[model samples]
Target: MSNCSGESNMSDVLKLAQKFNCFYLSGFRTSECKPFIVQGFQVGLIRPDVIKQLLSFPEVFHFNQDCVELNPAFRDYDTRSVKVDEVLKELKTKNVFMTLKGWRDECYEVKTQFDTPSLLKMDRSATCLFGIRNYGVTINGFVRHPEQGQCLWFQKRSASKQTWPGKWDSMVSGGLSVGHGIFETVYKEAMEEASVPDNLLKNLKSAGCVSFYFESERGLFPNTEFVFDLELPIDFIPVCSDAEVECFEILPITECLRKILSQDYKTTNAPVVLDFLVRHGVVTPENEPDYIKIIELLHVPLQTIYWHRNKIKENGFGANEIQGSQ
Candidate 1:
């Protein structure tokens, strides 16, 4: 709860939703009310009669004009029985999985056993329709100097990457897949992306989670990133073992901040680095006019999407895999 001191020049940084072409909906954008009435609200796009065909399975969604609302009852049924995954797979086969803009196939998961259940399993590819929440890991690898201050290590994603190709990103990042634990995924991504050894991995600090919801050409991306802070040796250099990264660079904290402000880093990477700068005193509350807003942007409320993780049964899948930093 401490405040940062710098007045940030990145005041024009895009809002989470606007960065991805999305808007919150309590009601229609126009003055007229929507045709069908529903209790709760949803995050989605104004597509054609797409929901009409999907409504055949009454338990999945309720359609109103061009808007589609996820049925709350789908959560009661088991994963396979609800057939949400099966339906999406079929849709993909028929080329119904159209992208309004460009495309990316970054994969993600949908847990139907949670609150609202319309689509069972959605990946990075199909999130546009329903705005499903996705989880991942991001590590801030840095080195401290007694006199010169802190330096951050950044990676340039490969030009071939499905999402954010050729953009500067956090030192390490990867999706939190269905069967992996936080620590396990961290270890895997660090080794695969940056070749970080287990010796250094043992020193990783869990800095908690950052959540944000955005809409992109692919779809609505509701993301929660489990952020880790790792203090690496000053001379340690990172080598990319996987084709996911194009190269690596170590920049002074100021350079990193400049890149973020200039929009040189990937869209999501800005918030992660901004949080770091604020926490480390690089950007203080006094200097940054939007300090409070930046702080709030990192922790969006995800109670409904995250509830099932707490209700896991003894025999539940990946139950043993869920835990804190190793």
Candidate 2:
């Protein structure tokens, strides 16, 4: 078999993560309870037995007939103020694989908006500490050549990267931590990854977001990425300023397509780059029959889960206002 461009299946790579409703790949299992409604959002799902374990942290979470939720009392508290160490420690002591060591230090918050009050806070490494959604960002850098046309810049990840080591990735990408805004993160990541100066960073255009519900060995990853398109000058070259990227390469748009189709790009980044190509008219229905499917795959129906939760809350159907309600 020839491992070449046309031989690879783009649909296989571009397909949205399989979803059981708003949740991903969760088959109908009686023991598995519906997802929890945290401040009117489907933050995560838990088994009935897991709900019992979470009850120990009464001030941190509330339980109802069908779901678990963040205790309303903590809405006004600092993201880190709601203490969850005891519950996490209990899960860890119980040998829950998701709560194991080396994943519990950097704090992460679950909030509807960046500046609004947080619904819950936990360690970044503990996403599966309890399955919840986290947001990130990916920035694409490209240059328009008079002769070669549009070309994209890709980074070869450092071998030491804890996740997806030694893979080709977008020009810049990073997790949107609790305290940072979208643009702030873009500037920081751009400077760190590709040495793009602030003056150049100012030209970045908001390219909306790409969302997916991914299941990994670590746990469920219901993620949304804010995408940015950066058009660099043709004469500009990217320099690696961080250890995350081993090196950088600028390739013609056609070669970029070949590399991505050949599975040379990281899994998450492939979709992001594909989105960029489609939006910029590089991939069109005339040339690629699957272009429409590729565009749809970049967005999943994650909002429906939260919308259902909101509607339920509007009908006066929710967890009891009292702390630790049965």
RMSD of each candidate? Answer: 9.0, 7.2
**Top model number, TM-score:** 2
As a TM-score, model 1 comes out at 0.72
Please write out the lDDT profile of model 2 over residues 1-326, one tens digit for every residue: 76654435654434432321124435222436556666566666565555666777777777777667766555544543445655676677776554355554666776654345677677776664355667788898999899899889999999987667899999999887778778888889888988998888889999888876665555556677899999999988888786888998989987776776654567666767877877887778888756665666578655443444445555665422322221
Provide the global lDDT of candidate 2 against the true structure. Answer: 0.68
Query: Best-fitting candidate, measured by lDDT?
Result: 2
Error of 2 at 89 (Å): 4.9
Give candidate 2 regions above 4 Å deviation: 1-33, 39-41, 47-65, 71-76, 79-81, 89-95, 98-104, 113-116, 262-264, 309-326
Q: Please report, in order, the local distance difference test score of every candidate based on alpha carbons.
A: 0.63, 0.68
